[model samples]
Target: MQDPVEIGPYPRKPPVTIVDWAMLVLAIVSVIYLAWITFWHVSDDIHRTIVYVDYGVCAIFAIEFCWRWRREGWGWRFPVRNWYEVLGMIPVTNPAFRGFRLLRIVVVLARLGRAADRAVGDRVTAAVVNKFVNTIVDVIKRPITVAMLDEVADVLQHGRYTTNIANALEENRAELDAMILERIRKDPQAGRLKFVPFHDDIVRIATDTTFRIVFQVLEDPRTDELVSDLVRENLDQIKESVREKDIVRRPGATR
Candidate 1:
C-alpha cells in the first residue's frame, strides 16, 4: 500500500493591512466626534460641521461594509448580523438615536479583537470554548438505538446522500482501481505465485469452488428462514433486557 500523504498546515489569513488600521482609527474618531456633538449641545455652525463630518464617515463605513460583503461572497447575512452599521448610515436628526452611530466603533473593535485572536495562536482559548460547547451538547444529546440509526441511514441512503456518494465513487473509480491493482502487484506472495506451474489454473479452480459454495448456501431454502429466525430471537431478547432495566430503574420499583 502507498504511504499516507502528509498534509501541510492550512494557509494563514493575511494580516490586517495598514489601510485597515487607518480606517479603524478614523471610525473611532468619527464616533467620538458624533457622540460629543449629539450629547453636548454645540453651536449651530459647529454642529453642522460635525454632522457633515459624520456623513463623510458614514459613507466610508458604507463603502467598507459593501467591500466586505462582496469579499464574503455577497451573503445577505453579513448585513443582517451587522445591523448597527446599517442603522448608523440612516440619516436621523434625533440625538437619542444618533448614539447608534457609536455602535460602529463596537463593530470595528470586535473585528480587531477577532483578528488579534487569530494572529496570536489562541489555541488554548479555542480548546476551552470547544470543551464548554461540547459539554452543553453532551448534556442535551439523546441516546440512540440501532433501529433509529437504521431508519435514519435508510432515509439518507435512499435520498440525495446516495446520489452524492455514487457520484464521488464514480469520479474516483479509476484512481481506486489503480490503487488496488498496485497493492496486488506489491504483495510479496504475488511474484512467487506467478512462478508456480499451473498457478492460473489453481487460482481459477479455487475461485470457482468458493463461488459454488456461496451459491449453494444462498440457494438452500432454510438459509433465509434460519437467518430471519435468529435475528428475531435476538431482537426479542434485547427488548426483554431493555424492559427489565427500565423496571429496575423505575422510581418506585423494589430492589
Candidate 2:
C-alpha cells in the first residue's frame, strides 16, 4: 500500500500574501456582480457579463474556502469535516441561507481583525462594541427590580385575601378596635399603639375618610379566629428570637 502524502508548511502568511488580498477583492467584486445581476439590462451582452462574473466569483470563493479549510486543520476528517469553512461555494443557497453565510463571513473577518489588532497592539473597536452592547443590556434590565416589587405590593393590596381582610376590618371597626383596646388594657406588657391602625393602610381605598371595610367572609367569627391565631404564632416567633438574643447576652451565659 502507498503511504499518504503530508502537506508542507503554509507558503504565505496573512496580509503579505497575495492570495488573501485576492480573496477579499473577489468578495467585494461578488457584491458588485450581485448588484449588476439584480438591476442590469437583459441583453445577451449583459447576461454574458453577469454569467462570467458569477463564474469568477464562485471559482475564487471556492479556492479561498478550500484553502481556509485545510489551513484550519480539517485535512484528516472525511464527511465529518469543517462544513462551515466551505459555505461560499453554494451561491443559489445564499438567499435562503444568508444568515449562515454571513456567519462564515463574521468568522473570517474576526480572524483578520484579531490578527491585525494583535500586530498593532490594540483592540479598541472590539472593546468599544463589547462595552456598548453590555451597557444596553444593563439598561434594559435596570427596571426589573422596581417592576417586580411594584407587582408584589399591588397584589398584597388588591388580592382576594387582602380585600377580604380589609372589608372585615372596616365593617367591624368598632369591634376590632374594642379587641385591640381590651388587649392593651388587660396586659401592660402588650404592644402599644396610639390608636387602632386604620384598615385603609392595609388595603386599597378611594374615599376622603380613607377607611376600608373588611369583607364579610373575613369578618366571620371563624376566619377572624384563624387570623388571630396566625398573628399570635408570628408574634411568638418574634418574641422567641428576641428572648434567645437576650439570654445569649446575659452575664453568665454559656458559649
Candidate 3:
C-alpha cells in the first residue's frame, strides 16, 4: 500500500506566516464575539448583526453539507440529512428540536476528526484490494479444486444413467454403462457371467459423490442448485453406457 502523507507538529510561529496567524486569531476572536453576542447583548443593532452573522454561518454550513453529500456519493437515501443542515434553514424544526440539532453538529465534528486521522494513516482501498485477491487465491487453489474435477467426472457419467426411479425399472435402462463396460472388458464374462445393470446403484454412487465434492465449495444459492443439476445430468449419462453380460449371465448383469 502507498504510505500516507504526514501533516503534524504544526511548526512554531516566527510570526507564523501572517496568513496562518490571521486565521488563528480570527477563529479565536469569532468564538469570543459569538459568546458575547449570545449571552450579553441587549441592543437592537447588535441583535440585527447577530441575525445576519447567523445566516452567514448557516450559508457556510450549507455548503459543507452539500460537499459531504457528494463525498458520500449521494448513492442512497438517508433517514436524516444532518440535523444541523435542517436547523440552519427550517425555523420550526430547529426551535422545536434545537438540542437534537446541536448534537448532530458534535457528530459532524467527530467525523471530521476521524477523516483527518485516516488521511494521515494509510490508503484504505489498497488493503481492501489485497484482501479480496487473497481470498480468491485461497478458494481456487484449495477445496474448490477438488469440487471442480468431481463435477467433470459427474457430467461424463450422468449421460449414461437413469434420471428417475420409474425410468430405472420400467424402461429397461443401463444405469452403470461406463462402470460395467470397464468391468466387462476386464472380466471378459465371455460365457460364464450374467450381467444385469442396476440403475439405482449407478445413480446412488454418482449423486453421492457429486454432492460430497461440491457441498463445501459453493455458498451462493444459485450456484448450489446449478451444481446439483449438473450432478444429476452426469448420472443420466452413466445409465446409458451399460450393456448385458455373457452366457450363464442373461445379457446385462453388473456387480
| Model 3, span 58-162: residue lDDT tens | 455455456556766764442142432343332211233333433434333333322232343322323443569666464444334344445566564444332
Give the distance in Å from residue 144's predicted Cα in candidate 3 to where it truly belongs: 62
Look at candidate 2 and tell me the lDDT of residue 245.
61
At residue 35, give the lDDT of candidate 1.
53
- Candidate 1 — which pairs collide? none
Runs off by more than 4 Å, candidate 1: 1-15, 91-255
TM-score of 1: 0.33
Give the best candidate by TM-score: 1
* Candidate 3 RMSD computed on C-alpha atoms after optimal superposition onto the true structure: 25.4
Ranking by TM-score: 1, 2, 3
* Candidate 1 per-residue C-alpha lDDT over 202-249 given as tens digits, one digit per residue, 9 for 90 to 100: 655655565456556655656655654555566556656655665676
- Ranked candidates (lDDT, high to low): 1, 2, 3
Query: What C-alpha root-mean-square deviation, in Å, does candidate 2 show against the real structure?
Result: 20.8
Pairwise lDDT winner, candidates 1 and 3: 1
lDDT of each: 0.54, 0.49, 0.43
